[model samples]
Target: MTFSEKLRELMTARGLGLRELARLAPCDSGYLAHMREGRRIPSAKLAERLDQVLDAGGELAALVPARRARRKTPKGKAGASIARRDVLALAGAAGLPRGLSGPVAPELADYFRDQLAGHYTADRHLGPFRLIPTAAAQYDLLCDLANAARGTLRPRLWSLAAGYAAFLGWLYQDGGNIDRSVYWHDVMLERAHRSNDRQLVAFALHNKAMLHADLLDGQGVLELTRAALQEESALVPKVRVLALQQTAHGISLTEDGDARDECDCLLDQAAALVDQIDDAYPWGGACLTPHYIDIQRATCLVRLGKAADALTLWERIMPSLRAAGARRDAGVFLARQAQAYAVHHEPEHAVTVAGEVVELANATGSERMRRELSALRTRMRPWAKEPPGRQLQELLSSMGGHT
Candidate 1:
């Protein structure tokens, strides 16, 4: 029987409807229906998923031709590349192999690397509610191609998968989904290990430290960071700084008497590495610079109750953060500054800055900033019945109680 005939028969025998099978398919449900009617061709992955869904025992998959006819696509601007998602879909449609041997392998790598950079920026502009689903979907598609990839192509594909997972981990963490954040962090570690690249693996392990951060598990962060740094032989400047930053954060969180001194020293060490590093990668932090490290340093100092000092450093670097298109982060930093003000008993300015944070969070839809706002509201408890505190509460209520 033809592929569709067999699919229909299987559905009939199983008492499954097209929509039901399509819902369980790996690809878009709408696309499955179109292919079922012969309005479009089925891809290898699509056929594979369909076979498994219908219990065809690989029969439906085997029906996919070795190759498919290419369709025309709109070309990108002079230098821009097509989105890799489209590339994968087209390859699936044409039954073409993917990997180092595939024509799109090199282009796909470049495309993803570039998008990785763009996403770094997008993370600043786009809220987690918007970016999380997109990144998760991209990770899923990338994983499929990476699994099918072979030979020399495996390294780049795996690296992309791991990196995307890390990105998702960060996004989910920002979205306040701790479990999902940890899940992607684990996926990053698994994918990176599969790639067998020490540097990428180190990047993945370092990402787990971030997952523990939401829970303020200083010991967990320190252990994960130490594990990541053990790959020092594979370390680049970016990973080095990231590992150090987490170390600083963990140290600050600990109750040790010397934690402040140790954390301060680690920040200095990370700073020294900043001058030596000049390369950026898709893995870990390709955006690590002196400013980034300093931001971590200031944040650490704030947590350690060195409010005045941290506020000084934060103001000095505020311009840099703003210029980087990190409006969401900028809002968080403002909240930190406001926190410092509250600690210094400067209630008026603290409340003023808190207002700015509320405005920023509303504009960006950043759960990170929202969490900070909530913290600020709690901090305002002493003054809750006061005008500034009352105003902050009203602002928070306007955000659907996110604050």
Candidate 2:
């Protein structure tokens, strides 16, 4: 696609207006309009900034040609000949050749692992649109390392690759790109097994199970969670608890009274297991806190038609969420709380909470949050003519009708 077309497509996907993109890119909106009309071409620098602003994954930048001062390298790429020569001189002074300065897989692995933690933090606080490109670039670099690594470094590199793949799968899922998510999960499973990282293998399986849960595949959720739990060694506390929780969720979706009993029992067991988590280990449990489990439990309660119980639990959980993690998740929970209130006929409370959810969704540009809140609005349709309901409808409309 032409640079203009790609930019437009990305803006639409990310729900950005031309002025919004231009303002965020710190460029002239008129220049952008002219570029779209093919009257003017974007400079490479502008293309790069646009790519970053739109999270286009370099799509815009790739379509633009570099001005030749011989040739220009993009940011994060090799510098000019002078820079390379300076680097070579420094390496010579250090008694190490330029070639010998190539990446050490162990170091690369550690770097990727550390970066993964930062990526996770970003995932919590930033929307997928802001971070997906960075995540993909990190994964691509890890793949390059995996190809060149040998022996111990090779396995280590693969382990890190698997980690990034799993992370990419999650990023894609949050971005509502399910096909990419499935592809990355399968890649994660393969690489995890190849690297013999038992913990990661279990993690990948549990991730797949959670995906199945999202897809409303109760049986698939059960199967994958069980497979995760059946790993040879004892799984990490968080991983084990997650599997148990997924199993409970899967069972809760079924109509069997006996399964519901099992669901409750599993949840109780999972709660008790939380105390066993060791803080010293680098546990990947960003969403596995006691509070998170309680939130999940509340969701199950609502699923079981116990909206009042869910409302009580939501109230208890609300005070603790200090806007620390994903705005998307926070917005989602707020919408759920609003739903609980709505279902319980607390129109004022529902409308007030829905307003908070919608505002957050708008601020963060989180489609997932918008979708959840929109569903809540639909659920409140019977009360649409009520004062609170009418207020919420107006609020949603003012925020751009479609979720």
Candidate 3:
């Protein structure tokens, strides 16, 4: 049977309606409806909630998309079932790994080392954005290594786990199982404290600030970002600076002029230090290019209502953003572009860009992106019946959403 079929059967057997299922699962009813209709796939985090609510022996597979479902080969043989167990093993490994085999299998050590660096960098580029399950897999492997080798593991191992936990907290802002992300963050922070690694602490705080930003808790963002900046060392790694910058950007959203000014100063400091620091390379996932900076500046300009300036920056940065396979990032830039166009009273342009935003948001299953697009739709509402307003409304309605 298909995953959705299983879900339908389970719900019926349990005497639950769609709304009741959504209530028990703690997600939007529409989101649940979409899943039931096979129009949407539940996130790993969401599946876990459904598992508990349905009392399905923690079998999340019953709700996985049909495409992701395990295949049964022969009755006596196990294929995907074993694969699923391996997947679970890896997840459990996130709690703790056996240990870093020093004299380690060169390949194993290399994988852990590479994974650690990759996750840290990935955290930077995502900018507190929650990651999909595939992306989270990287951190889980590194976490396993850290957990398995308590005393024998290198200090960097602890840093890796803490950094990953911090990233997880940012990515799964609303839907994640708290036990792994937030709870893990607390553990990571405590570990960082024990290690007395201020850089790691700062990085973790920056991530926590992003989580607060996701919650629209601007005060929390400011408080945590400030703490992170305080702990950031002049000689900190470049990725660490990027982490701080993400928090600074979050602070900019608070409309605090003083915090904004301070953030600017810190940006300048980061830039100046960028040239002087040796080996202060971009973390693999967090590579900051001139274009990335321009995008960041443009975002700030938009929030500051410097629409013309933001437009100029967007025009210049669009080529590179599109070239980087940064579809999600591009989608965001387009959403902002739509907003800037609306602010400038260019409805036609706003309509064009908003279309791009909705398309990308839908493709990525990004509710956050959809929310931003929804806000743009609201701003465009007063001009109803116009091509722009009609375009926005049509897109929202198609998504089964409203402003």
Question: Judged by TM-score, which candidate is best?
Answer: 1
Q: Which scores better on TM-score, 1 or 3? A: 1
Query: Model 2: clashing residue pairs?
Result: none
Candidate 3 displacement at residue 138 in angstroms: 5.7
Model 3: clashing residue pairs? Answer: 96-147, 97-144, 97-148, 130-171
Q: Estimate the TM-score of every prediction.
A: 0.75, 0.73, 0.69
* Cα lDDT for residue 332, candidate 3: 72
lDDT top scorer: 1
**Per-residue lDDT over 9-46 for candidate 2, one digit per residue giving the tens place of the 0 to 100 score:** 88889998876776687644545675665434555777
- The residue-level lDDT of candidate 1 at 301 comes to 82
Residues 264-313, candidate 1, lDDT per residue (tens digit)?
Answer: 88888888787677665765553353377778878788778888898788
State the lDDT of candidate 3 residue by residue for 1-403, as single tens digits. Answer: 5556667777888999997887677655655775676544565677878878988775555547543555333344422233333544543454422343422222333444555466544533443333434334545555555554445454555565565555555455423233335655676677667546676676667666756665567788778777777745543656455665665577667767675575666566556555443542212234345565566666666666667877987888787777876566678778887777777778888888877777776665555567667667766876888777886787777763433
lDDT by candidate, in order shown: 0.72, 0.71, 0.60
Summed over model 3, clashes come to 4
